[model samples]
Target: MVTSVAPRVESLSSSGIQSIPKEYVRTQEELTSITNIFEEEKKAEGPQVPTIDLKDIDSEDKLVREKSREELKEAAVEWGVMHLVNHGIDDDLLERVKKAGEAFFNLPLEEKEKYANDQESGKIAGYGSKLANNASGQLEWEDYFFHLIFPEDKRDMSIWPKSPSDYIKATSEYAKLLRGLATKILSILSLGLGLDEGRLEKEVGGMEELLLQMKINYYPKCPQPELALGVEAHTDVSALTFILHNMVPGLQLFYQGKWVTAKCVPNSIIMHVGDTIEILSNGKYKSILHRGLVNKEKVRISWAVFCEPPKEKIILKPLPEVVSEAEPAIFPPRTFAQHIQHKLFRKTQDALVSK
Candidate 1:
């Protein structure tokens, strides 16, 4: 005989609002019961993601720069991810950004609601606590806020936090620094592919249309961590993503058909190739599949900046330099919007059937 399990419900009390239902707080017992089902057996240790120094890439020595470029190519082709050090962002600035995020999240729930995401309107540039309404069993164990930074005109202040007055300033400064780093990295990647340094940048539409978006993710400590996933497995949908992970070990990526944890390194940033790059390279490079694991003890926080083509509708195709008669295009041309919409649809479908 089959048995039916009752769904769990949670409540949230905002400042003015009396009660909010279906917030999805799991109990320890419930969490433990599902742990065994999703747990994976530990695999033997293997190579970790490659680490590269930005200083070396900027060296005046031609041989030194070429060597760094080769290393980048190897990392991009083999792991689709790498750890970046000495990227030139101020350490104090990084700390300030993290502190700003923490302060906003710590605000009274009512205050945070002012920036709540409007799913019906298809705007994701605000705060979001729950993944889906009334979908108790299908929720992800995290809270996030997203916003666009570049092209200043595209910024939607309605969703930006006003309580922490410096939040905007801090994030903006950090993004500026990241933008510089991203441009350099893109040029290095082009060289690695045997193309003119400016070729890839030109194809994606120079700095004028370059898009940079920020996502602040907070993963609260879970009572039964093993049973819940902080984030489900998926590949990013942008050209590249730079992650400022707090001192936590919850990030993991699939490499060589095995899951490997991404350990945090001090004073460094983690870079992951996204779907756009894979298409642009004609599959010469890969978009890494990764996920977040929850911890029963520590709450993890991370800041991710996704760099991609502008919001304008432009079809992304494999560049001619990377595709030829000898090596045809592996991925067909598609607009960035189309690619993201499809990914979201698939994620929604998966959530609906998750339990």
Candidate 2:
């Protein structure tokens, strides 16, 4: 329920401010934790997020395909996030998608405001900046443009940028490709769980009913980079999130009591297993907590596509295949909308307690 009308970080960075606003500053403890991340990473021996090559995913050799699937499954269980190389999306298409997002973010503030979101009114799509609904009310040092791109009929083209003539066209093509990739990942994950290849996908939502939402995150350079985060730590609610980021590094994931910065590979897409998948898999798969950090140099941009279930569809419990007398359902039945409401309510209560 936090509605943001704050100034974009891009504008703030260029405003000649020596430091970020107090509201954007983190507490001393939070600062200390992140400041020593490098030292912690050095001492820690944890499973690093794996980079899996998907070029041979459809290989004629059955052993090669099986090995690829097992690697993906292990990454899902251990880290819940992984980078995919040669994911079949064309290099030209990838560049076009990045350029489209960059073009939109490069527009003047007023022009960008034409598509601003009204989160207060429950409209989440379009351009906006979110102020975290936490105890300190810290403002995330990022601006984003969000909208659903799949199931073409669900699109609201009015909010889509018009200034960049090819934005819609390029993004639409990218979405279709990502959707296929998502389906393939789900199939492999399902097989890994000893279920039919399509079991997990069907449990969440079939291809036609699934929701694919796109969010373009632009983390601008910050004056006080140590004190402010580009994004707050949290887990994604979607089933899967496929990301394409400009090679500048900032993404960090919590793993085995350490924060590990994900090393970016050019022309690669990173994928995350989200809460929905974790719930459906009966906690067998993880939904790791992650956040974005900002730096004094260079803007970091990422394009994330979330594969989700329709709001009204009920995730009635963990998949039958994953549950047994030994391992019962760990999560309660809830519609996607109810799950969102519960999370929002929890945030509100946490804020109140901290205050």
Candidate 3:
């Protein structure tokens, strides 16, 4: 995708999307001095979320669908993340989605406030700076698009901006496409786990009330990026996650007692197995924790689509077909939302992010 305003660091390294520095989070201690000053200015100023206005965003690539089922399964089991080459989303849709975000975020605070996420609606909307509080309870480095993705009820077309009508369509289309890809992955996982081909689809249908969500994160140009963060170290609340990232070096994954770069590939989607999935599998599958690091050099854009359970559904044990009585439940039965809120306020990386 061609853009006049993407980060400048895209050319800094050989890896287009796969080159975030390792241990990027822990390296910032002293530089944060300026942040305290900036924080004061932030307190005195009126709310002004940063945004880059664009007429549209577009790209032409199909590279996430070519993975073999075996490879998909292994990615879920081992890394808890993968690079998807083709799963059927167009460049224009992706660009427009990003453009819509740029425009929506650029809208006046009053305009952005009109459709704020209604607790009753279950659609977490509007804008939030530092939305995800980390284990330390400090504000997250970047803001995000936290809203419902499914359950026909949450699709309030009226609340979203129709003037940017094409934006809504693009997001809806993106959601559906991600759902299909998630289903495909789930199916492969079932087979990988030695279950009958249709086992998960049939039994897991109980989770239809579960809806997905999207985190459209745009990290603004930071003067002290290392001192700040785009996101914190936390596992997802859903069963699965598919992340599409452009060239930005902010994404990090927790692995083998250390943080590792996510090796983001252009036109590839990174798959993250979530806490619920790990629980359902009796800890067989992994749910890796990850953090996003903003840069002093440039702004970053990341699109993460979470594949979740139905709202009322409890993401507990997978199924009797997938496991035995000896295995037991990986997690205590609870609603996915409950699990997320419990983790949000809780401290410590190990506390809220596991089975």
Ranking by lDDT: 2, 1, 3
lDDT of 2 by residue, 62-109 (tens): 999888878889999999999999899999999999999999999999
lDDT of 1 at 222: 64
| Residue pairs with clashing backbones, model 1 | none
In candidate 1, what are the lDDT values of residues 232-288, reduced to their tens digit? 668998888999977777777878776777767788899998898888999888899
The C-alpha RMSD in Å for every predicted model, in order, reads: 6.3, 2.5, 12.3
Sort by TM-score, best first: what order?
A: 2, 1, 3
lDDT of 3 by residue, 51-93 (tens): 1111121122223322355556666777776666655667677
Q: Total backbone clashes of model 2?
A: 0
TM per model? Answer: 0.84, 0.94, 0.72
lDDT of 2: 0.86
Candidate 3 C-alpha error for residue 153, in Å: 4.6
Runs off by more than 4 Å, candidate 2: 1-4, 36-47
> Residue 295 deviation, candidate 1, in Å?
1.0
Best by TM-score: 2
Q: Cα miss at 98, model 3 (Å)?
A: 2.4
